[model samples]
Target: MNRRGLWSVRWRSAVVWVWCSFCLLTLASLTLRYIVLYIHPDHDTHRERWCPPEPVESDECYSWRPVLLPHATCGCTRRILIRHTCSEDLSPKMWDGQANSTCDPDGSVRGPQQLVMSISTPFLTPKRLATLSYTITQVNELYRGWVLRVYTRVNKHSLPSLCSLVCAHPNLDVCDITAMSETANTVHHAAWRWGVVGDPLVSTWALRYLHHALLPRDAHALTQFINSNKCWHLMKDHPTHSHSVLGSGLLAGKTSWGLSELTGIRKRILLTRHVVEEEQVFRDMVTPVIGRDVMTHDSLTCYTSAGAVPFPSRRSPGQWVGMPIPTLTNSPQNQNKSHKNATDIMPPQLKVFSVKYNSKVNTTDGFQIIKNQADNDDVNEMEREHINRKNGIPRCPHSCRPPLHPNWDYC
Candidate 1:
């Protein structure tokens, strides 16, 4: 053994020790980051883009919910690769920029991170919610969708004052209010509107004359809106591809769901300012005749003269028993001309009927208007006593009344 050999061995030992120390430190750093990140983890390092399971088709609503994450988490600040159809990667302006972009099968949706209303990083507070609510009222008439309330929550301990303030917010349902304050690293929520209405029923007014008819001319329009359809979709016959339990129930007046089943569904119809915003032919005639407030309210009264209106075959599934229902579809583009002409759109059969509406509830039990063939269509002849009552008409402003003018009936 020589001095040179001894020196080489000592140097090799020192290098190995240094390398081991560096590797141990690096491993520790990564572990800590993993623990800190579970919520809104770094997009670059963690593949936080967990493609959640799509919501199953519910019996109540045509729409489904795909849970984005397990809990409220901050929006991923980094660009996330989204490879799914009908889902945007928490990013905005990705697909909107493409004029004719369809949901591509193999293609992916990508862009800037989608920013949502959260406590931090574009923080939105309780004060903002109230301000937003107030502002909504001002422009509510101008736009159809106005949210009177918002539901959200935050870590009470992280910002107790902000948490308390938000929790106490009126019209807000702040879940998990008592939990310890979470660090600002996490986000809470945002809610989407579903058109479901409570246990509801509609009363149809029956009529026989062609001289004066309310809904006979606009029955299709009323039915369209009542079925949670857009006016334009009603114009020529394009169904929005969405369905509602309330609308379904009203069609048969039998499938009416209990509160539990009804609440499960949200989309009853687009709760726009006007029930029939499209089908312009009914424009000036129907709206002014029937107050907008009454038509759009959660409940509605339908005065059908002649017991039947020219309802789109699709709109009324079981209204006519044993008769094949027509699938009356309209043009999507007709939405453009929806507000155009009122008188020109009515089908002649509708001439024998009319419709009026009331928001007030007439009865807890629903109503159905059956065709009375033997008697005269005049109000007096079609009295409740004279009519054949198979299914009792539901409560209404004028239930079991003859198919006559609203003025004559004072309904």
Candidate 2:
């Protein structure tokens, strides 16, 4: 072969090798790119999935199942001890005497016979719900702590105003006043309180709890929100009660706290007053504790002038939230028997928690007189002061003002 022919073959071989290398590199780059993008997945589309420690098999398929974690904060788990009003004044003369007469109230109060949804997903599972329940309880604790601080600082006459200041603004730091009032109302009128005198401490505790559950957990975040009276950067319409409903079902397995037998002496008496006649005296005694508004209606009465009557309005057949108060150590084991009511698989839950006391955040509102305070400083200045007060830090660097330019021009 000629020299030129030999050189041409060598060059062509070199060119082919280069082309092959380029194609391989391009393919690898594309593969790496796909792996980087697709392997772990993105936050926007991922759903939370908890794999059970052990596998569960049924029918043809098998999957891991989550172990039931006992309700942590509350008392025992075997029987969910609930408070209720069993009897009250049944005299026809009283406002609610007509309806306070039935144990079941035609089932409307029990809510739908079962949980409409399954409790399997991360949203509905025990752990997540327990955490949320804990958070709610913690918030209540913080509110109490704050109230104690305010109460200590001021006298009785000044309490309401200070409470108003602490709870006044519906800003980012605090929960909505309307919601707080509603919770206070609920606690005051709980079945346990029907015929009993009201206790201010219970109201205060409930107020703190419901509000704290809806507010931020971080102290700084809470402080910023409270000072501003709004959810962090939320709009005007953002304070609706639905915020509580958002994760409630997932955590508590249901939204409403089912009002059952009204077991407590006060509540039972109040509830009983509705079904049986001549329980009138009991109702009167209980009325003050639950507040006058609650006493007017019969605990067993299904319907009211307001609308169609539902279940007992209090008791319902829904999954109870959290474990019973005391840790379920050696408590009777609830082995599921075949004949057991399928519905009974999930029992009523009463969640109890150790109170966390944060010395900031107050939550008393409604019936509060609004007042104008002197705006001696701008919002900016107030914000700075707030930061300074919350955390002992200065806004600007210390002792560092800009130096003056001596010569703007040749003097």
Candidate 3:
């Protein structure tokens, strides 16, 4: 071979070797990243570590485990993606940005303040289980500093699946209500009785049980700060009666005072022998504290039989956007049946949108409200863009469009 040809051959061989080496290095980097994320060195240690018991007086001992999401952190860029959605990412603005800045390394927000939620169900069907999982995931994503307490009455067969769901998230705790005699004997019995007879009183008893059971040790401090109510509470109210409709009868409050007031309502319900609704109780408790100024006509719209309605634009800022539960069925027969009543069965998928707040609004008073509104706006914009792209619609360029005139013809 000629000397020039030999030099060309050697150079070609060197390029091929370098390319192979680069590919190998890239593969190794990706593999290491995957291992760091999914198979953490401390994963086994964290899983094996004993969970601390709740500092409360109760026969039923429950422990809380940290919800570990690789993408989520106590910073501006934290995001948690839901499992079954169309790869739609949660808005970083959903959580209070100020709170994020002050968050501890452990992902907890500073101060004695925390959000608490309780979800209970008598039976855990596949559909109900998915809904429960979605709800918990949404809570974890939206409220980073919040603690979710889940109580389920599932059989031994379903226990592992429930545990898998709970263990994956941070700031989440689960208690098998059926496993505890204290709860099983009283609240479980009441729930079953109410399920059969549609007795409102019996249902109220079950709610009361959860209200007290799910409270943190520092629940007493909830009402201490009148102007700056620290603890927020939300409880999922499942249908206890056979005839009751599947609705988002979620009981929520800006402060834990609403939870504490349940005791007073329980006494009132006993004295009057009246069928007092839980929604009515919540409204009576919260209306005075949050004030009539913040509430709109549709503020209590989720209390309706139709489930979660679209949040009105004029509604109070900082209120949670109502998420409609989608009818998720895998069976062909069920899908066909669901399609017939698609309007009724399948509501619009959960979309979090922000409401515009007055610029003059006090930042101290409406910090969370403003943050949520901004988050919703960003999420809504992203969702709209996603839909447009799916439908082959071109997104209008932000540079060409002015903020004041969104519908300008030129844009």
Report the number of the highest-TM-score candidate: 3
Q: Output the better candidate (2/3) by TM-score.
A: 3
Tell me the tens digit of each residue's lDDT in model 2 across 1-47: 54565378788899899999999999999888668657753321222
Clashes of each: 35, 63, 5
What ranges in model 3 sit over 4 Å off?
1-114, 179-249, 254-276, 280-320, 331-348, 351-411
| Residue 372 C-alpha lDDT in model 2 | 18
Better of 1 and 3 by lDDT: 3
Q: Against the true structure, candidate 2 has what lDDT?
A: 0.24
The whole-model lDDT of each prediction reads 0.26, 0.24, 0.34
What TM-score does structure 1 among the candidates reach?
0.18
Candidate 2 total steric clashes: 63
Error of 3 at 188 (Å): 8.4
- Structural similarity to truth (TM-score) of each candidate: 0.18, 0.17, 0.35
Residue-wise C-alpha lDDT for candidate 1, range 1-411, written one tens digit per residue: 545553787888988999999999999999877777765443333131221222345453332223222112222222222323444443343455542211111011221111111111122343333233222222222112111222223343434433332233211112231131232112222111111122121011111111112221123233333344111111211111013211211121111222332333212222223323212313332223222212221111333221222232111110111111222123444322322222123323321222221221122111222232223233452453233222222222433222453322211
Q: Report clash pairs, candidate 3.
A: 66-170, 67-169, 67-170, 67-171, 354-376
Compared with the true structure, what per-residue lDDT tens digits does model 3 show for residues 1-411?
555654787888998999999999999998887688576643222121121212333432322222224322222222222211233223333234433211122222211234444455666665555555555554443343455555556577666555555455555445444444343334432232122111111111112222222111112112122123222223222222213221223333332323334444434322322233433433464333433212111223224422221221222212222223445554645433422222222223332221123332233321222334323443355565565445333433333233454442111
